[model samples]
Target: MKHLLTIFKYALLLALSGVLMWYAVRGQDLSTIGHYIRSANYFWLGITMFLSVLGYFSRAYRWKMQLTASHQTVSYWNVYHAMMVGYLANIVLPRMGEVIRCSVLRRTSGVPVEVSLGTVITERVIDVLVLALLLGVVLMLEFNKFWAFIESLFVDKYDSLAANRDVLLSVAGIAVLLAFVFGYLLLRNLDKLRENALFVKVIAFVKGLLAGVFSIRKMENKSLFLFHTGFTWLVYYLMDYLAFMCFPETYSLDMKAGLAVLTFGAFGMAAPVSGGIGVFHVLVQSTLLVYGISKEAGIAYALVVHGAQTMLVVLMGGISFIVSAIHSGKPAAQKQMSVSR
Candidate 1:
C-alpha cells in the first residue's frame, strides 16, 4: 500500500508538470523557439556548465566541513559522490534525494542517517534564508518594475484570505487549542512514553539530528565555511549572468536582470517537481516577460539554459552513481571472501 501511494504521488506530480509545460508553450510557435535555441552561443553555455561544476564541488566541500564539525570523518570524494548520486535521484523523484543521499553516505562513510538528515535540514534552512535575502534585494532594487507582477501573483490569494478572515481565525484558535491539549497529554504520559522502545529510538534519533544541526557552531574555521557558501552562490549568479550572452534577445540585459533571474529561477527550481521540469521554465519565462522579452524568446532562453544544466547533472551524476556503486560493492565482496576463507 505504501509503495502504491508513492507511485500515485509521482504520477500525479508528473501529470502536473506536463500540464504546466503545455500551458507555458500553448500559443507559441515551436519552430521559432527551436530556432532561438539553435542559434544560441554554445560557448557561453559551456562556460556556465564549467561554473556549475565548480559550484557543485564547493557545495560538497561545505557539506564535508559540516560533517567533520559533527565529528564524522568522511572523505571528500565520498561526500561528493553521495551528493551527486542524490542529485541524480532527484531527477527521478522530487525530495527523495535528501534521504537517498544520506543513505548513500551511510553506506560509504558509516555516518548515521539521522545525523546526516539533520545536517540536510540545516543546509536547506540556510539556503532558504539566502534565497529570501536575494529576493528581498531584487525587490528593493527593482520595486517599480516588479511590484505589479509580484502583487498580481499574490493579491488574489490575499484577498481570498481576507474574505474568509472570521473562519480562518476560528480555525487558528481551534488549532492552538488542539496543540495545547496534545502537549498537556504528552507531558502527563511522558514517563510511560519514555519506556516505549519506539519512543526511546525516536529520542536517540532526534538527539543525533540536533547534534548534526548544531555542528555548524562547533566548526573550527567558520570563516572558510562562509567563504564557500558565498562562492557557491556567486558561481550560481555568474552562471545566470553569463548565459545572457547566449542569445541576442537577452544579451543586452544588465547585472540587475541577472540577479532577478537568479532569484526567481531559484524559487522555480525549489518547487516540488522532478528537476523543476515545467515549473522552472514557466516561472523564468514569466519573469523575463516583465523585462519586455516576448514569451517565445523567454521560453527559448529558459529551454536552453535549463537543458544545458540538466544535461550537465545527468552526465556528472551518472558518473558518480557508477563510481559509488563500484566503490560500495568492494566492501561487501571482501566480507564475503573473508567468510568463505
Candidate 2:
C-alpha cells in the first residue's frame, strides 16, 4: 500500500515537471529547442553520466563506512544497487527512498528493514546539516541577491512575514507540544505490547541499524568518509555545471550561478513537490534569472537540465535494479551473506 502511494507520488512529480517544461518552452517553438539540442555537446552528456555513476559509487563506499561496525562489508556493487534503487524511489516521492531501497536490501542482503530505515534517517541529518552550512556560506556572500530572490516569490502587496512572526511562533509552540504528547503515548503503547516474537526481532533489528549509523564511532580513518563525501558532491556540482553548458544562454554565468542552481535544486527536492516536479523547474529558472539570464532562456535551460538529469537517474537506476536481480539469484552467495546477517 505504501509502495503504491509512492508510485503515485513519483508519477505526479513527472507530470508536474512536464507541465512546467511545457510552460517554460511555450514561448519558443520546437525548432528552437531542436536547434539547442543539436548544438549541445553530446560529449558533455556522456561525461555527466559518468560523474553521476561515480556519485553512486561514492554513496556505496560511504555507506560501507557507516556499516563497518558490524564487521561486515558488502561489495560495492551491492551498495550501488541499494543507492540507485533508493534514488529511483526518491525521484517519485520527496524522500520515500528509505523504504523502497531498504526493503530491497532487507530481502536480498539480510539487512534488517527497520535498521535500514534508521540509517537513512541518520543519513538525512548529515545531508541536511552539510547543505545548511554550504547554503549559509553561499548566501552570506550574496545576501542581497539571495534575499531579494526570496522576496520575489511572494505577492508584493499582501505578504507580511515579519508582521506575523508572533502568531507563527505561537502556532509553532502548540504544534511541538502536541507532537510530544502524541509521541509519549505512542511509545507507551509499544511498551505495553510484547506478545509477538517477530516484533521483538524487529526491535532488535532497529537497534542494529542505529548501531550501523554509530559505527563511524571509530575515527581511526575519517579520511575515507571525507573522500567519499567530497567525491559525491564533486559529481553533483559538475553535473549541475555541465547541464548549464547545454544551453548557450547560461554558459556565461559564473561559478556562483552554478552553485546557486545546485543549492536551489537541493531545496526543491526536499519539498513535497511530487518528486521535485514543478518545484525544480521553478527553482532553477528563478536562480538563473538572478544571474542576469532572461526569463525565457532561464526557463529553457532549467527544463533541459532537469530532463537530462532525470533521464540519467532513471537509466542508471534501471541498470542497477537489473544487476541486483541477477545477484539475488545465486543461492550460495545468499547463504554466505545470510551468516553475516
lDDT of 2 by residue, 1-341 (tens): 99998678667767776787566666666676566666776677778878887787788778766655445555656766877888877776656777887777665576656656666676677788877876887798778888988677665633676678899889999999999999998688886655668888767877877775666675357887878877887788888888776667777777777788888888876766556767777787778778887766666666666677778879888887887777664544768799999
Q: Which stretches of candidate 2 lie over 4 Å from their true place?
A: 1-34, 154-191, 194-202, 273-275, 329-341
What tens digits encode model 1's per-residue C-alpha lDDT throughout 238-296? 99999999999999999999999999999888888998989999989988998999899
**lDDT value for model 2:** 0.73
Q: What is the Å distance of residue 209 in model 2 from its true position?
A: 3.8
- The per-candidate count of clashes, in order, stands at 0, 1
lDDT of the candidates, in the order given: 0.91, 0.73
Q: State the weakest 10-residue window (summed lDDT) of model 1.
A: 326-335
